[model samples]
Target: MTRRAKRTRPATPQDEHAIPLQQQVNVPVLNLEWIKSRLNPATLERLMQVWGLVGRLTFPPSSSGKAREGSRRIPTADAHLLRKAGIIEEASSTITGGWIIPFSVVEEKTNGLRRRWIAWPRDKNRDDPYKANAPLLHISHYLPPAMAEAASCLDLKASFFRVSLPRETRHLFRCRVEDGTLVELTRHPVGYKAGPEILQIIITSAIAGVTTVVHRLWAAPPSVRIDVWIGNIRIAGSKSDATLWEAQVLRNADSCHATIGRTANRAPRSTPSWGCSLVTHTGRYP
Candidate 1:
């Protein structure tokens, strides 16, 4: 009989510190309905926690001086496991100055559930260079009259403008028209610290002109109630300057008047006395 080779296993520490305390905790208790109702905030937080845990174990920090900094920032071993599971892509660090991992790899890993999670709107390109630096835009709200009309014209459920940046600093602009013209925009950055801001301006500019036209065509009265959200993209920092200009245009359009009570002093009230369903955008823009 041939001699059997000795089995070998990689060393793993069993100390409490070596093992994360979260691993000891039971799976998080979550209500499906509650989660569905408020999915954005909670789900994202939970997912990030899971990703962080995975990163720590799979890519522990390197001991050597130059490699130490790189190791400290490496994604968890679980991230690699996730990549193997088709939940995320194999983590690849960028050659750019920042030690950030590219967003493209993350996107490839997450592609299986792309629709499940809201993504930043941008043109899909297999060869485009800045794929890694691009941010994901998440659409939150759709503005009225414009939103309804855009949906009707485009035959889309929703629409949004998206932007992506590459290592060369060139930007890519894309219009994502689902059932209507884009009414809201959101972004999720992957690797670079300034990536989100760079993409936001591109997206904002692309949509601003069209949204302005829509606002002009759908001017309503002040008495008409209007609720506007700033959307998911942040309008601060160096990018704020450009975003502010776009915001001004939106504000001007939002100030238009609809046919409400004749007197300026009179408070306009809904005549139908029925609450508007959030699911449908049938009534007049408010």
Candidate 2:
């Protein structure tokens, strides 16, 4: 009598780059309240200004590059996140954006793919002598002496995390998915040439805003300076008995997470959260 052979499941390959069937370890299961709150119109307009969205700005022009047609291939996992977040949507004939530049979806590897957006390159309008300036911005790489104490550096994901954009600029961001469908971007993109410069300005301004708030709330210790260096915001300061600035900074950052984006302040915080509070929410979000 022949014994029945045991059946085993097929093994799945571990190729991270494989587009199909790849899974993300962390998908932010759509917090409706959070999403709705962030999408408020008043918040969107202010966020645009804080993000340096103004009269004239475009992706860097490619000196050695030519404009590619359609969208580049996107990893399945990364594309899913975009759709879920409402970042990318199908274009309609009435979509009144100015241009339809193609974009690439980027990836963030973990237990699986995270996210990145395809970007970088150029364009020109009539009569404007195009200047192909180098895509370089000053990055402040600062860290206090550490004081050998309990100083912490919060890695804020300020760059390319999605924010509001003018509807007219819709012509500037477009993507063609694998199924031959054209898509449009509803939010600001990551991996663009201007990301670092814009973020540096915003985060630095956030630091200043926090500074002003902290100063007003408390009296002594005028040295309560917190710096968000490295083009990303960080809660920089000392925790010695001489001051409680670190604690105050963290508290203020968490508080500012929402109100900052809504207030009329020139340094409008795009997202309700920034700096340390965002670090704490890493597990809660993606």
Which candidate comes out best when scored by TM-score? 2
Q: Clash number for model 2?
A: 9
lDDT of 1 by residue, 36-124 (tens): 22223433354334323211211223444221111111124323322232222322232111122221111111112111112222222
Instruction: List ranges where model 1 is wrong by over 4 Å.
Output: 1-68, 72-96, 102-193, 207-282
True-vs-predicted CA distance for residue 216, candidate 1, Å:
14
* Tens digits of per-residue lDDT for model 2, 17-121: 443332222222222233223233543344344344322434443454433343454445555666666666766664322333433332433233322343332
Candidate 2, residue 47: how far the Cα is off, in Å: 10
lDDT of each: 0.23, 0.39
Model 1, 232: alpha-carbon shift in Å? 9.6
Candidate 1 local lDDT, residue 171:
16
